[model samples]
Target: MSPIPVELAVDAASAVAANGSPRKTFFGHPRGLSTLFMTEMWERFSFYGMRALLVLYLVAPHDKGGLGLNAATGAAIYSVYNAMVYLLALPGGWISDRLWGARKTVLVGGVIIMTGHFLLAVPASVSFFVGLGFIAVGSGLLKANISTMVGHLYPDKNDPRRDGGFTIFYMGINLGAFAAPLVIGTVGQSSLGYHFGFALAGVGMALGLTNYVLGSRNLSAKSSVVSSPMSRAERTSMLRKGLFWLALAVAFFGAVALAGHLTVGWVTWTLTVVGLIIPVIVFARIRRDKDLSTDERGKLTGYIWFFVAAAIFWMIYDQSGSTLSLFAQNNTSSKLFGFNFPSTWFQSLNPLYIMALAPVMAWLWVALHRRDKNPSTAVKFGIGLALIGLSFGVMMLAMAAASGGVLVTPLWLALVYLVQTVGELTLSPVGLSVTTKLAPKKYASQMMGIWFLAVTAGDCVAAVLQQVMGDAFLSTTSFAIQGAAALLAGVAMVLYRRKVRALMGDVH
Candidate 1:
């Protein structure tokens, strides 16, 4: 019932009622969570729906209405697009902190996202890339901010309900992801065509937008806009500068594209360089701030490991959409129980696994805390890394089984996803919680964006790896190397867990 921590900087009115009585509830949490939960569910529907189709569409033959790109080219495009979706979160956080509030930014993002999905339905070459660009930008705006808004619903930092609440929120994301492939994949791979599937994704986004608008009254009004908004002139200046840089980038790329020399390879390379440099610059700037105390600086340094670990985790996990998707199409058997399913449905396993595991894991976190037995964040991360690494080992075994151009059983891939999902449960939500805990007060709002930069880093490196190695990216040696890196990272985190704990001070 007290004010939220200053480091979070969320207004207290967000969770406190004017009347101060019993409030409406969704499954024993705040009613507002339902709004956020449903909104995110539909947004993910749009995102994963399109995601399930992107690589397949690119690799499909020209006669089948695809772009007819090679596996390498398709993977490159997928990786780059994924990179941009996360990379822009840095600026997206800036925009929300200074101009739009979390609520407004999410709304604007939804509109843009809907537009992008519809554009993707056009079935034109120009529209496809353009649509992806729009969705990336919109998603960047919406992603971190919406998560921040969810924090607003929980005013008490020590409330035991916090982790469980987030688990429910996370489930909303999984719900959308679980359903998208079945619905969109079936439609796209059917007689109706891919563009129709894209359109349906847009329809899902539109539904989400409608739900959000209608439920706005349930959200906190005080937190609907930026707390300290920029002045008109400052806002104008910032916009102008952003536009100038953007125009320069567009012009440069447009000229190259017109000359037919700007390929997916070029875009991915640029993203790789930018992604690698961003974390360095941001980390240095934050670390050097004079306002920080000795303990704060120590914590920031510890965060570097977390950042690197997250990058490694995502690099392998996200390949489900690209490298693994291609494998499903080319190498995995689709027939199960005498019924053939689309390869795209394999992507759904992640969310399905998450759905099944989230509740038990969520309850375990709270119970462990209550019993004073919860593992330190670093240890949890160690478990996560180990699991993801093991998933790769499973992949290597599957590769061996399919050595002579044989189609491996779907069970092999399912096992990989299952192991990886458990790893994700250990690390992903814990990462979000720890990022908010360790972040500096002055830059409270922007911390989520900094967190997302880890994803950008992973995706960029992944794209670059695929680009440089080309077809060799599929080799068992590649999986072995990546898996070993993760396993080693896990061991290092555990061996040095005491140091990280010291760096965290009282937070963990």
Candidate 2:
């Protein structure tokens, strides 16, 4: 791709840096915010854009420019792919803290991600899996580090603007997500073919990289510095160990391939099992740490509860890309005002709702805070879980309405997304903020990695659930079961809120 014009980049930078010093302020916050916001917007644009096409491309007939895979296999691959994206963060965050630092890690990740998209633009199975692998590794590096830098932008943990900054940063994420399906999905799935969509995603990543490069000067010194540097001898020893592990992984996968056992099912199950196990081990280790004070141990216990809530919420929410997308295509009405909408467009609803409601929710939190009536984090988490359950409850009703082999109105799916978006606002940002706040200083980066492991575990569970649920995904019975499970979890959280709050100490 051609480089973004330097003149335009200069002009944009100047516009964002109207004050004397470019580092001083932009839109009443750090000028670095502009760079981070735009960078993440484009990164998400690429990520979601490609995701919108993933399952569709997998299940589409080869004659129609698709891979012709079964729905179960496609969903399995998708779940594993997403799980790896989050799972690798454990090592990615470590590398950032101990070696590359956030800035270099993000830059390397962006390049890898761009390459992944371009590889996906190739119409071959090998390229497809390779591309997925690259994107997963790249995203693992970029996601947590960028958010870490956002926190770094505000040194004062008590800064009232911190939450607002994250909220605004989150808006960037949604904005990219909102645009991807409408633009990339529409064009890529149309006469242009799926490869075109992949290409567009690549272009988005390229732009993100460009933005990051041009605005690097505006970033705080903290963004570039390694938080926990190691000696050269230590680094060399670590590198040798990493290489040994990498070779072992390659050998194992090569053996699986040679044995003709390297199918999607195998990959999916392996990742699922690993994803589930890692968090358990991590939590056990943390709980056993002899250095932790009683207060710290209590906070860690409270964090586990929050972690459980987050994992459950994500398992349900992430269905939007798998079973839910299939429902939109096969079960929901596509017509509105006499025009048939692309099923992929339904994927846009969550981000659209998020973009519209995030600001309102942010303001509401602040407004309630002023009155000393803001809900505690635990309560908000309960509310979020309940809202997600309600979203599925809407799905159950929609399934019932379509019981007779008829397509239900698309509005039902839209309503589900709308409710889920509200739930997301309640849980996601709060989760990110609290993870940073609650982490022990020495293990800060690893704690962030652990937070993502919850997401990985959720995706793993989702994969297994997708396989087991299968076509039941289209039935009212399945919806009812899932919805009820979420509601029960939410109610349980509420009942335990007082205990959790006590453990949380003064953090809330």
Candidate 3:
């Protein structure tokens, strides 16, 4: 918890500014940060907007705006979609690094996402499948790189504000997430709502893309570390040969086998195989060639453990989009502020809570650190896991209060989200900045990709959990067990914190 040395902090800041960002804080930080902020805000708006409606659209009666799919199928498809979105970070990172650079890849990703939303806007069943595919691919491309670009704005070592900057960026994510459910989820679930909401998500992305383009003046130039040296023409040609063919292959395979239908099992295996191969090779090569000091290697090892622990946490928390959303629709009493809240809109509670909690938590950490009593990353992560577990315990309690399928009050749902958001404040942004700090320079993007792969793994597990819980247990019971498991895992990590810290070297 010691403040990073001034020398190391300055070094980190200079590294981020290597792409020609101004040395001084603009509007309290780099000017490009706001541009990235707005871009990500709208991007999340689009994603969460679609996500809010995804399950409801599947389970709602056919005449009343849904496809009438059962909970299991919808949950399965939702899980696979979520998992693939994260898994796509591998290719997405490579594309940004080796072909178009981050800015161009972001632009291209926006277009694809908008197209996907448009496809979803269409009423035909075929368009629904097509739209989901587009969104998945587009999300894969945009989400990872945008975050990487934020890190690129800062150097890897010693910048205390790097963690804080990611916290601010994390705010943008929640802001969009907060808005989407209120706007798109409402419109999509009501009569004549689905198409309107889908179109709105698309337009949101279009505006985001436009804002980035117009605001390019305020941005730093591409980081040469991530940008390929090839000219635009050469890079375009290479991308055509590589990504286009790969896309075609994926399409061919998906169409012939897994296309249109929700192939949860297939997507999971595909991503897992890709994840296993890519990270092992990337890390092995980095370790082989990079003359990293013992300290660096130790930090990297700690990062690996942190990644594992965080993945388990995400698995329980991410059910908001799948199992939790379904519970809100089917079991929760939705009346609030004298209105019948749209079930999908309840998904906003976590982000809304985050917007309120993040800054407070930030200050608390600083205060704790100042007192020389701040918790280690491992301890915070353990707390995160326990909090996640506790969210489910609340759900179980709510279920017991409701009695025999009676609806639980909206307040109960709100409390669960509140706890989860606090846990997120402890874990999510902290993990992001820590990963950036701990990863060796030669393997930063690859390590980030691996972190994302851990997320994918978590989503896959959540999906399987959702499916099993749907048939075998009450929703609250399932959540309770998952939460307990996460809490225990977190406690285990805390008990092992000294060893983990030793392995990680001097993260502080």
Instruction: List the lowest-lDDT window of 10 residues for candidate 2.
Output: 1-10
What's the TM-score of every candidate structure? 0.90, 0.90, 0.83
| Global lDDT of each candidate | 0.85, 0.84, 0.76
lDDT per residue (tens digit) for residues 1-508 in model 3: 0111111122334435677765555345666778888989999999999998887787777788667777866776787678778878778878887767887788788899999999988877679878988988988888768877777666543456565666567667878888999989888877766778898999988888888888766665653355655778987888689898899988877685754653544554554455445545655666666588777777777887887788788787777887778878888888977888789878888777766666688788888999999998889988888898898899788767766888878888889888988888888767867888788876665767777777777777776665656544445567568878898988998999999888866565
Better of 2 and 3 by lDDT: 2
Whose TM-score is higher: candidate 1's or candidate 3's?
1
| Model 2 lDDT tens row, 371-446 | 9999988888899899998999998888888877799888899889889988988888788778987886656657
lDDT of 1: 0.85
Query: Looking at candidate 2, what is the lDDT of residue 411?
Result: 87
Stretches of candidate 1 exceeding 4 Å from the true structure: 1-31, 153-167, 258-260, 363-373
Clashes of 2: 0
Q: Residue 168, candidate 1: how far off, in angstroms?
A: 3.6
How well does candidate 3 match the true structure in TM-score terms?
Answer: 0.83
Tens digit of lDDT per residue, candidate 1, span 1-508?
Answer: 0011111122334345678865567776778889989999999999999999998898888889788887877887888789888888787777787888889999999999999999999978789888999999999989858877877777777765565567677778888999999999889888888889999999999999999999888776644868678999998998899899999999998999999989766766877798889888999999899999897888888888899999999888889999888888888999998999999999899988877776678678888999999999999999999998999888888888878899999999999999999899899878877898888787776777887888888988888888888878887887888888889999999999999888888887
Better of 2 and 3 by TM-score: 2
